[model samples]
Target: MAQKNYGKKLLLVVLGSTVMGIGIYLTIIANFGSDPLTMFWIGLSNRLGITIGQANLLVSALMLIVVFFMDRKEIFIGSILNPLVISVTTDFLLRQTITIDSVGLRMMFFILGLLILAFGIAVYSLADFGRGAYEALVFSLNQLFKRSIRIFRILCDISFAIAGILLGAQLSIGPVMAILLMGVSIQFFINHLSRPIYHYLNK
Candidate 1:
């Protein structure tokens, strides 16, 4: 039974990561903007003349260093897999640009990307395997400050968004919406979707 449950969790992690990659790809192709962390990565990529995947890996590594000191327990197989899979998948998809000339279609894609990203986050949380470096940073800060997860999450996003903007990443509607909506959306999914799925899986 333990083995079976572990297998299920592993499966969830892979699926969730893949879904997240798809969401990331969609948002990038939409050309509106991306989530805070991704925005920062893209900004760094542009400035450094590197691939977004490389920027992502570098950022994740730095965040993981902090997590190591703040809360090492959060580092697990999923932690490594999360960044590796997402970066590779995102880079591959990014290379294959799906052009959308219509502004309306781009907006639609952005909205769909946001939804997919939120759902992927919820799936990852439900698996309980481990969190990515950014998620771990948020959780660690929440633990240190004794604040609500939602508050820290929003703050983290805002900070990243600001930094990204300062680093020359375009501040657009998509990023603004992401900053405002991501924490709330993730919480909503945890309450309405992840918990239910967790209960079912454990049962």
Candidate 2:
């Protein structure tokens, strides 16, 4: 029974990680601003002359350093898998496809992508495998400040976005609004779906 449960948990982790890739792809397709980490990857790629996937791998490797220092428990197999999967996924999504080009089309894709991303996050969070570096950082800050995780997440995300902008990353109203709105959108999904996912998996 214990082995069975462990296998299920492992499967959930893999699925959750794959869902994360989908969320990232959706973020790109939305043509709005990407999440802070993606913004960082894109910014660094532009500044340093690396591929986006390579930038992501570099960032994820550095994040592993922080994860080891701060909380090893939060850093597990899925942590490695998530970035690797997303990089490949994002690369494929961007290169092999022509995304919506028109302003209205882009806006629609952006909104729909946000919702899909939120759902992916909700599922991933509920899987109870491990938190990504950014997620772990938010959790750590919330614990340290005795503030809400959601608020800390928002603050951290915004700070990263600003940093990306200053570092010569692309910035427009779409991405700026993402910094403001993503937290609320994610919180809504978390609130509505987290419990059900938890119970389903735990059972």
TM-score of predicted structure 1: 0.90
Model 1 residue 190 distance off true place after TM-score fit, in angstroms: 3.1
Which candidate number has the best TM-score?
Answer: 1
For model 2, which pairs clash? 33-175
lDDT (10s digit) by residue, model 1, range 1-203: 49888888888888888888888888888989889988999899989998888888999999998999998998887887888878888898888857899999998888888888888888887888888889899999888889998788888888888888888887898888777677678788778886677776787
lDDT of 1: 0.85
Query: What TM-score, computed on C-alpha atoms, does each candidate reach?
Result: 0.90, 0.82
lDDT of 2: 0.71
Superposition error at 55 for model 2 (Å): 2.1
lDDT of 2 at 174: 59
Residue 70 in candidate 2, Cα distance off native in Å: 2.3
In model 1, which regions exceed 4 Å deviation?
none
